[model samples]
Target chain A: MKKFMNDPETFIEDSLKGFALAHADICDVTLNPSVVTRKSLRREKVGLVSGGGSGHEPMHSGFVGKGMLDAACPGQIFTSPTPDQMMEAARLVDTGAGVLFIVKNYSGDRMNFEMAAEMSENKVAMVVVDDDVAVEDSTHTTGRRGVAGTVIVEKLVGSLAESGANLEACVAFAERITGSIASMGVAFSSCTVPAAGRPTFQLADDEMEFGVGIHGEPGRRREKIAPTDEIVAMLLDSICEELKPSSGSEVLLLVNGLGSTPLSELYLVMNSASKWLNRREVAVARSLVGDYTTALEMAGISLTLCKLDEEMKIHWDAPVHTAALRW
Target chain B: MKKFMNDPETFIEDSLKGFALAHADICDVTLNPSVVTRKSLRREKVGLVSGGGSGHEPMHSGFVGKGMLDAACPGQIFTSPTPDQMMEAARLVDTGAGVLFIVKNYSGDRMNFEMAAEMSENKVAMVVVDDDVAVEDSTHTTGRRGVAGTVIVEKLVGSLAESGANLEACVAFAERITGSIASMGVAFSSCTVPAAGRPTFQLADDEMEFGVGIHGEPGRRREKIAPTDEIVAMLLDSICEELKPSSGSEVLLLVNGLGSTPLSELYLVMNSASKWLNRREVAVARSLVGDYTTALEMAGISLTLCKLDEEMKIHWDAPVHTAALRW
Candidate 1:
């Protein structure tokens, strides 16, 4: 495969090593069970931890720092992390206020994080995010798959936790974010796992996958490639349909690039979504555009709309210091 | 060409519209002769302006904000922006303290920026960046081509300008940065300009273009893909040879992605480079990694090294708030 890595077996380890070294001021990497923890833990504050498969980077790991995730456990590419990884991460970042696990809605992730929370000696709470509105079930998930909206949930809840919220309050805010956000993705091409050494799926030059998952899982349907406006409308339609915000409601719109999509394209998608929302009299209160969550070298874009309240807006604007995100 | 664009002719405009919308808090986009200028100009500070072909995104435009560029002019994809665009940007951002034009060493860009400076009424100084050590002359340039190092020049010089340096001092610091930094890129696959509807060039499955330019210009040679360590060594060797940094010298290292390469891969490259630099006893005082400057969707990585002084280190740590970068 045409990837910048040494061995498929050691891909995650190698990347984690680099990640820790690059952001040495923010976080540290612990090998054996594989966990990324904040360099400095805030005393008596809720510890926020998140994790999942490896390929969708800057997601769990890059989010580990002040005002975001306190620890992250990464699994093999497109594979869920073991329960031990999560427990170890909890052990590292658990202040007296306890640890709150932000688990995405995937069967493996849900099961493993639950086990980790149960096994932890420290007070622990879990908030499962199932924000993707693409489908009811998918290859790795039993219900709606958590997608780009996970980033939004992480940011808002992390901010709340950093503000010295208790574990119970952090979990409530995390759940509130999960309920308010909706995401859907479209792929022009599929990404390959390094070990697999080939694309997970294929699309004709003129075909596109709608509502695709982060792991190249099947979406709602496959259709001919459409213009930017039409594709954006389709994704946003799905999101707005699920969330059903009133005409005067406000939202934080996120245009996320899946690995290989250009920032220009992601912004174009954002423009289209904003225009679409404006027509319905929905206000875009805040916006984020770039590659926050990705599926390896997949060429795709995901649109997330989070119905925002004053609390969400305030915390979203709060300071954050992380590798992939900061303000 | 599986790109998420409406029409090739309107790609840049659409993207810019979205960019202006998403970052309305930081910058404004002017359409006719496109220019992205800071939302609030810091009056009397030397205005830092940079521009180039559109594809290397988050470069000229995304860098326009506080503690960075005051303005950026974006041309059509892979083509130099017009003199009018540059002149308009200078007109918009110049606040009595004169404008400093940071031009990459591309023939077309140099000519257009020079013409813009000459025609404009505002006092202007230019620093042409030719940081690439790949070749003495290349397709788009007479001297070495400026690649990722332009970001370094803009960051350092931009910081100096933001710190209220005089136009002359800013120009001197820009020149110092232009001379101290060196960069080289390698491409695993070619990128397609939307209008072209085809890849810039083709490569066999196992081959890679070493010392490639940001525009997919021919590099030193095509060779079979090598291990990550070997590739990192070759790139760092060329940079060190040209820069000839002493063993104890401290430098800022930037591992930049060429649009489509994954962040994991970029961080892996950083890990390898850090190891290589440590072996030589050269200190990596500061590190920046990710897709800062990118060719639309080229799958490659570029390494940039800037020998650092205490002054540069202090300014490098200065706060910058831009779409693609912040601290």
Candidate 2:
């Protein structure tokens, strides 16, 4: 509950100033309003811009560097960035090649990024990643949702663009990754945003909610504590059924820690995933076990798997340089 | 806190499986125990290996890819990888050029990595990074500690080695970056590792601690909550004085969240950091704002700064490919 800030209002602005000051090699900040973009002046490649509420570091902004996003419009903590900011980023990052907006499948993010993409003069391609496999849509809402799978789309499309692929190619690549990737998360405890000064949601000492969202959104089902293997099986079963990649198709597994799960726990979940997949004889080509994308200090882990072909593999291996992710 | 694991002992292995599956293109997992390595075989370049407990994801394993770590040894959750695992990793990653072990400044990590380095007959060099500015020698039971600053060392040295720097030169470069870098963190709450199933430490709602280590290790002092500026001031006063980089010296700043802190809170703190450094006229060459190194959803941010010269900047900008960090 303790936070360091002069005022909640100035938090985003001040943080952007410091972030801009430090990452001059790869990023620059826009004035008057506020936005982040790669330092490259040409903007010759198909510009890819992404943004959302600010709490997720490295996601919207940390991805702005070579082989990734051309720009990112960062918003207030857990709040959507203004549409105007996204438009400015679109203008700044657009090369003659055009621009693309990668968005998580959240109501606020979808609405904002989509609005910006439509309003901007630059030829814009918009892709919303909705790969969370945790939720089963009710008649009132969309099935599943976007969570950590957003990062996979960014990586896939960013690398394609960096390799001189055009906007169309980038869009196609983004779609492919989005289709293949699936994520499911569970939360042991709710995270309290500093300004909010309280837990987002309440959980008992011995309970956990399966399939939680990043913003502490409600998930499909709540369950009691279970063995890591059972949890992994539940998550993987949901994702595999959703993705349904052809048998023997290679897959990339991501065991993501919600904010609070320790790496050890993540590892335990991943071990279950490996055994489960091996038993099925599924070829897991690569594995990423860590906190790639996180839910604020929620003690849980999400499993994301992206089915891959040779092209995706090449894209995944391409060199990249960003503050949060570098490979 | 509820956790997802069949047994405490199986966490690391499962997680590595998920990790390997998620990044199949860039990494390969060995089943006969567990070790992850880059797919690109480099026979002539000196291989770099680092590993420790699983809780700190992307630290040792997530970093294994091009232009960074070549291989990572997996240990049980919150436990150091055995010397045998490290040796296996060293041997697997080594090319004719030699191998370098980048060990964080922790007793277990140092001892394990050192033993691996010594056990291997292949020419190997080792560099231990102890850049946490918070751990004053006076209070430490043993020696200086490593915190978030290890990321900078890993990236810089990884780039150098990838570019074919010799073992000694790589060690020297890592040493140089480690010497120039300093980091300090503050935590509002203690994190609960899943297996442990309890708070690492307890804090009153109104209390906070400065100089916290990443593993929920207690800092030197605890104090009542102060204004953001005052809190940041206390941190800077300790870290800046400890670093004491000359005025006008170029510095790279990293404002890192400890897992749970939202971007809004981090930004607020960074505003204070920017104003403080500007008041001192310290030249900031660059900065990185995000969760580069985190303590399993601890609700806080750490500030890291490194005095930078032309060489450091060159390496800083170099391309890298890894699971957690890319570019």
**Which candidate has the highest lDDT of all?**
1
* C-alpha RMSD (angstroms) for model 1: 0.9
Best by DockQ: 1
- What is the C-alpha lDDT profile of model 1 across A1-327, one tens digit per residue? 899988877788888899988999999999999999999999998988999998888898999999999999999998899999999988888878999888889999999999988998978899888888999989998989988899998999889988888888887888888889999999999998999999999999889999999999999999999999999889888999999999999999999999999888888888888899999999999999999889999999999999999999999999999998899
| TM-score, cand. 2 | 0.82
- How good is the docking of model 2, by CAPRI class? acceptable
lDDT of 1: 0.91
Give the alpha carbon lDDT tens digit for every residue of B148-251 in model 2.
78888888888888788889899888888888888888888887776787888988988887788888887878888888788878887877887897877788
Looking at model 2, residue B31 earns an lDDT score of 55
- For candidate 2, what's the RMSD? 4.4
Query: Proportion of native contacts found in each model?
Result: 0.74, 0.70
